[model samples]
Target: MSWRPQYRSSKFRHVYGKAATKENCFDGVPITRGVQDNNFCAVNPRFLAVVTECAGGGAFLVLSVHHTGKVDPHHPRVSGHRGNVLDVKWNPFDDYCIASCSEDATVKVWEIPPHGLLKNMTVALKELQGHSRRVGLIEWHPTAKNILFSTAYDYKVMIWNLDCPEQVIKNPVRTISHHTDVVLSMSFNVDASLMATTCKDRKIRLLEPRSGTLLQEANCKTHKASKVLILDNVNKLLTSGTSRWNDRQIALWDLDDLSVPLLEENLDGSSGFLFPFYDPDTHMLYLAGKGDGNIRYYEISSEKPYIHYLTEYRSNLPQKGMGVMPKRGLDVSSCEVFRFYKLVTIKALIEPLSMIVPRRSESYQEDIYPMTAGNKAALTADEWLTGIDRGPVLMSLKPGHPTGESDGECEKDQAYIRDRLIAKNGGKTDSNGVAGNGGTTVSNGQDFLLCSPPKTENELRVKFYKQQDEIRRLVDLLHQRDVRIKQLELEINNMKNSQQNSLEHF
Candidate 1:
């Protein structure tokens, strides 16, 4: 059969420039499929980590990110787990430090040599053991140098401080047992002060680990375990999961109220979990999954619904795993803002797909390509452990247009929110003395006002509903405790009677 384009429109062709320009060609790393889960891919600027299942056992490959145009079978690798490794994360602050969790119910921290990728399996520098079952996820704090979090099938979350003097000989610093089921996914906010976790019980919980506070918990009515992502600004949260009708869905929630999602969109019925990547610079979010050939992206805004569908990048090859490059690692010369590393297991290929905003004018878009946080570590591991109230230093996204010029595009974007308010309120001023349309505002060579509308009856009802639910939960817990106490008392009385009878007979 002759080959033809699957898409009716040629819009996908121009997404990443020419077909050859989309993919950065490199030799594929050979891996044995079916022996391990396809969720073991991670990358730093200097190295790429992939798990390989061989006849002997599963091993982790650390390959140089720079291209040599040749594949080396004898790459530097790590093999300490008896079973397959489930997840791996490169330390955000330390390039040499990498953390991996495995099916052996343990998490291990490994350090790569300064020279380059190792040619053989190397021992881990430290092993973290606490979970009774398989550990599947591990995450490093965004700003903290040595803090790490890991979750397992045992329904436990462990927070580790690696730089502690007695860490190697002791357990994690704190253990969170709030989750009633296996935690499927987790994400930390930009400043690392808050974290969100989605679990097998179809529940999502937000936490402030430093204060031991459970910020929020809401039931997610999904068919399968879901993944939660905190948006760049930390005021919004997003989750991807399958509905009861077996349809994939993405829902956006306001951090203040989790009782209802502000927006929910149903998608295809694919079974793979969606991994979301968000770019703060352009307010773009990309969702990719296993066994899928297309990537769907959205543009987030301050308007109602919050997410606007942009477009999708389609390909014929199915992906088994995917990873994304840090924003600082992108090629700013081509106006590229995000790059995704897709793992094609069947073909044993790792493809780099770069997403760029095409422009005809030959100029560097300052607003789009503004200064971002580099790969440099702000604090040493020991220093962070001893520090107090540490906050991450992230690149602030500019508020104007991508060109950073006072053009029509910039004016339109700056006025979009103000215009929406004017339309909604019929151009009337609110009680705060700010008009919906004719008010002085804050902008670059522009004036716009933002007003907080009073809460509606619907919002009040949502809070009432949440309070009632919490009361019912607490009542049920108290009843269960009472029943257990009565049973214990009865057992104690029977034991006393038996002892008295024995003494009388003697």
Candidate 2:
């Protein structure tokens, strides 16, 4: 028989996505039915944020990632936007901080309570309102601490430095005016030194993110309705778009030379937009269509035919939007390398799919899960503004639930919390917030440490008691206030009755 070349060998070839069971899925979530091109979901290790439909104004629901099953209809929400929310992105360095853009022509940054939301939040930490038109997309900087990028219907890209310590920010730090039509998608390179965007004008352009300088514009004319993300590992740019024949296509181009694409492949003639996500550690690229149930993955290599097609994960429910859990948030014990939170609008459910590498050994698989990008940021907003570039901080997956934060960082956070609690209580505090012991250990049910989870039963009891005491005190105060108000109203009514009697006698 004539020699036939075989497919390339890859460890990730056998990796498959294992979806969660029905009981573990989020249910009764009123997902937004808006036709916006952007995904209405954003997730991190702490919380899952979903854009929900409400009557009076725009609102989105935030649930603890650990809390699955049925969500209460009266659950707390962040409903500050006056219009439909277009996109939501969590801060890489801070798990409790999230940024959202809305059709109200403003971008708002909200800080969720560390444990989770307890009541409806109607205010935001900062509000940026420079866009004359509705803001459609918002993305956080990969390496910097407080850098955010947003695009609006006004054909302008705006950058905001959220490091303001005194007051809320009203305008973006810089704005890039390049596209003639609407800007469809925007992405930053590895260290966020450069940016790539696909505009509605059917063109791809590369630019300097910090300075708002246009670097290069791709001249391809056939691919339209595109979304772009850079594979910084291979120094290549990938774009998913539609051909003139209405066929979906994916193209890979070199970063240095965007004059032409390095490779292009036509996908099926699906009308939905293709959202591309790349995991650098696994060298895997996943494309999930907007209105489809299939998630196609490929292996990107450095050799010829760089983009290698792998098997796809198929389902029956079409997804409205999707959110990816951070690499550090993955379940390393289950050999779970990647996780996607898929939003199924028809059922109003959020199902999680875990991409697993089938390994016989129960021990940690070091090869497959290397030191991936950690949750800690590499540079601050000031450092990035001063032209300093750094890659993402690296962390070992050996720690099953590594928070990607250094011990010193975690210690600093704990110390700050203890100081704040002490100030609020007007005394030195202990771990249980009582005025006693010398050593202070601020504990919570949701441990924010960088190691494996510890026993939280005691912490939960302590928290429950503290909350109970506060509620009791507040209730007593409310009763006293109500009694005084009743006494005043009775006095006023008696005076009115006496005055009416006097008037009748006259």
Residue lDDT tens for model 1, 1-506: 99985642222224452222323533557653743333568887656787776555557777656543445665547877787787889987666678988888888888875334424644677888788998888998777668889999899888887875553524887788899998888888776667898888888889976554788998876434378888856479898887778788888888778888887788898777677778766677888866887788877766675887778888886777777777755655577778777777776777777888776655556756656654444565545445444455444223221211124323443354444445445677667645544444322223333222226534433443443343334334555776799999999999999999999999
Residue 78 alpha-carbon offset, candidate 1, angstroms: 1.5
Clashing pairs in 1: 76-118, 441-448
Best by lDDT: 2
Off-target runs (Cα >4 Å) in candidate 1 are 1-24, 32-38, 166-169, 222-225, 232-234, 361-363, 377-390, 394-506
Clash pairs, model 2 backbone: none
TM-score of each: 0.71, 0.83
lDDT of 2 at 57: 80
Give the top-scoring candidate (TM-score).
2
Q: Which ten residues in a row have the lowest lDDT in candidate 1?
A: 397-406
